[model samples]
Target: MFEVERHCGPTPRRLRETDLPDLVTLSTAAGWNQIEQDWLRLIRLVPEGCFGVELDGHIVATTTAICYGRDLAWIGMVLTHPAYRRRGLARALMEHALAWLDQQGVEWIGLDATEMGEPLYRSLGFEAEESIERWAAQAPGHIAGEVLPVGFEAELDEQAYGVSRRVLLEHLAAGGSYRIRNVGYALWRPGRLAYALGPCIARTPEAAERLIRACLACRPGENWFWDLLPANVAAVELARHYGFTPRRHLVRMWRPGRAMRPRPRFRNEWIYATAGFEYG
Candidate 1:
């Protein structure tokens, strides 16, 4: 038995590295892949917005909202304890989190939900942006001439804050809001600039164009690839405009059951230059 509650506060002070095992248990129970690094990053970046419902002090249902550049807030990792479902804990946590994000002036919110979660998200006002896509390319020759006209600079070092911030903004343009973690990259090439997105203040389409221009300018003679949310209007349109085509699709899923009722509106917009394939 458990009590469903709404918690809106900073991350619990009692959290320790050892708590990861228990956290993983609940996350797995909810049908999510284990991602330890992501958990740590979320806690550090938005402790107050990360909420959980516990049964007799045992963490059960949980959700996190991570802030991106200017107008985006990414919500993810909505989990519920197996024994604690049918109690509405997931809905409590998610609604509270989204409400908090809305209060913070976040206009664009994003999340990849599991199939089971789709109904809840749709009810909560989260529409499906697109199915996710992925592709791979090798060597400079792979992306020789497919560049966009954004400025290109390599990370000075692994801990370079300047590079990390710029990359974050670029990512916001290409994909959607993304939480920053230690997803390390090659310091040498740092990948070529096939696109140029501006500071966070520009229109999404313009940011995307600059990103593509940057990619073209930097690579000049190679075949670069990008994976975007399947429903991203800008991405699908841009792909057609640039002669790119669909290669694959992925469906998201979650466990427990539906409690949320997010509305389905708004298409996801994607920029280039800083897409996922370039993460490596």
Candidate 2:
């Protein structure tokens, strides 16, 4: 397994399947939404990229990197058990992910950083790109409709995400519903505590609202979550109009001069909501 030297205690190592239980404990303690399956998906997608630090034979810190076909890589799940803080475990795990990604020839590395984590990432050469907010609301009544096939949705996602994430999209859409129109689309899936809406793309604010409204109407009266870029004023307004409140904030940061291409030809205006901070 991957291992790193530490001055104080046991070194961090590659995360294994057996670590799931302790990993869940770490996430739960941090108030994160990741379930076991979420961890499984990341491991299955990039086995060598998941790492954890242990103390007293119990996992205490974790981090993950998921590369999207050498185009870009997303770093997430950075968590440190409260009792294990101030030991630099989080930074060590992050450095491991970065070194691993670089070895794999990854060009762009991106992540959603919390206020508490921003300084570390900035020190590692990541610059803030945009602000993201978590919006929550009560689900609306059911609205009947069939989600379009994955092939159809991927085209729209490609335009908005600026990269091909067919694998990730397929996983997200497996049990989700999508509201699709010629101009936009919105997708939502069940979460541990609420329904999550995201990857919403559209040609205009009105189109985005239509798709979001339809998705919310599908599961009326239940709690819902939506993560959107604050730069999209219309999207923020749409959420506010729907009684959704911003509950959390994160800054999207990326390493400079690392994009494989100058930048993907995508329309930020069409991105009303991102798939999720972890996956993006």
Candidate 3:
């Protein structure tokens, strides 16, 4: 197990599957939108890339890294127990995550930074890329649409994200509905508090709206969450049209010195929402 000593507390170490409950506890305590399944997916996707700080035999802080086939690495789920704040646990885990990604020779590193964490990432040389907004709404009673095959949805996602994320998309599809049309697609799954919609990709604003509406229709009567890129004006308007309101803001940041060919572009106009901040 990887371990790093902190000046103010016990040594931090790599996270294991057994840490899921603790991870969920920490996330819930922080009022974050992650469930045990989400943590498990992170571990299954990048086993050695997650790290945490434990105290009294329980995890008190955490951070995770998701590597996209050595092309791009996303750092997220950075959290610290309320009582552990100001002790540098967040910074320590971040450094460890960065070092591990460096050892793997990842070409690029990125993350969606919360307001409180932006300064730390900036000081570590991460530059701002785009702004992400959290949007929420109540699900409608019903949606009239058809579910598409995973293969089709993956293709649309690849074009909008600028990278193939078949594994991630497949995992999501298995868990929730994959609504698709000739011009767009959307994937949504259950969350602790609401049904989450994301990674929505389309060829036009109208298609994007249709996809989101279809996703909402899949799980009516429940609250829904959508993380959007503000640059997509149509997406923002669509969210509003559907009674979705902005809830939070996150800044997408990236470290330099890595080249991502056809670099992951959101095709903002085509992307109505993201899978989730942690994965993207």
> All candidates: CA RMSD in angstroms?
10.8, 3.4, 3.1
lDDT agreement of model 2 with the native = 0.78
Task: Note the residue pairs that clash in candidate 2.
Answer: 139-221, 140-220, 141-220
On the 0 to 100 scale, the lDDT of residue 129 in model 3 is 90
**What does candidate 3's lDDT look like per residue over 224-272, in tens digits?**
8999998989888889988899999999998854454444555778788
Candidate maximizing TM-score: 3
Q: Write the per-residue lDDT of candidate 2 for residues 117-154, one digit (tens) a residue.
A: 89999999999988888989885445443444332267
Ten residues in a row with the worst lDDT in model 1? 179-188
Off by over 4 Å in 3: 1-10, 146-152, 179-182, 258-263
- By summed lDDT, the worst window of 10 consecutive residues in model 3 runs over 1-10
Candidate 2 error regions (>4 Å): 1-10, 141-152, 179-183, 257-261
- Tell how far residue 222 is off in model 2, in angstroms: 1.1
Compose the digit string of candidate 1's lDDT tens values, residues 1-280. 5444446422323234455666777766654334454355446556676777656767767777765433455667677777877677777778787777767766556666666667788787665544665433322333432222333232321122212344333333332221112222211122222221122111255555444444433444444455555455665566566666654444432211132333222223322322232121
After superposition, the stretches of candidate 1 with alpha carbons farther than 4 Å from their true spots are: 3-18, 133-280
**Which candidate, 2 or 3, has the higher TM-score?**
3
